[model samples]
Target: MKKIILTIIYILTLSGCGLEQDSYLVRWWNGNIPTKLSDKKEKIWDICFEETKYLPENTKEEKEKADMELNNCLHEKGFWD
Candidate 1:
């Protein structure tokens, strides 16, 4: 019984860790052209797009807005420098 409990705990731990993984890319557009962005500015924009995509579908509009703000912030922060 103890071994079974330990196995279950291990599985749960692994699953929980997976939840924190960042698999999305940020973008200025809704498209998934991650490779097209070569410059640092474009990359920052893509990161914004990816982050928005990772959010829940119900808040897509909000996420998109947030992504735009992120892009602006990146530019202001001299991402191209």
Candidate 2:
């Protein structure tokens, strides 16, 4: 019983670790993107787009990567603040 309880606790802890391990990019998106003011959204988006435009988006994975880079740029430029 003691070994079973410890194994369960260990498994639960490991599972919970990944649940909260979202990237900073994801956290910024989840916590800030929806609440951003409309007026500033355009300007900020323009900057991020320009910064990440050189990244290729020709494939699905490429597009996803570019999107992540764009989001990272947005987060760095105070989009999350």
Candidate 3:
């Protein structure tokens, strides 16, 4: 019984691990953008998604809003893929 409960809990935790389409981890850009040229882009991406300041509250709705805000910023800067 204990092993079964532990397995269930582990499964629940693993199920929530995923990357959203817009996530930097998912590589939204097309083709290979050299690291040299992508420094500024990387910084912006970090500020928008990786930084806690721009992440909004920890709620799902707040995260979605923040993600959209970041996507808009990237789009305005001419990054679309």
Best by lDDT: 2
TM-score of 3: 0.38
Per-model TM against the reference: 0.30, 0.47, 0.38
Which pairs clash in model 1? 25-50, 26-46, 26-47, 26-48, 26-49, 26-50, 27-46, 27-49, 27-50
Candidate models: Cα lDDT each: 0.64, 0.82, 0.67
1 versus 2: better lDDT goes to: 2
lDDT string for model 3 (46-72, tens) is 655553454665898998887787777
Which residue window of length 10 is worst by lDDT in model 2?
Answer: 17-26
Candidate 3: Cα lDDT at 16: 48
Cα deviation of 39, candidate 3, in Å: 3.8
lDDT of 1 by residue, 1-81 (tens): 999999999997886664523344323234644565457767776666665565454587976777677667667657756
Give the Cα error of residue 15 in candidate 1, in Å: 28
Look at candidate 3 and tell me the lDDT of residue 46.
67
Q: Per-residue lDDT for 26-81 in model 2, tens only?
A: 57747843445676777888999998999999999999999999999899888767
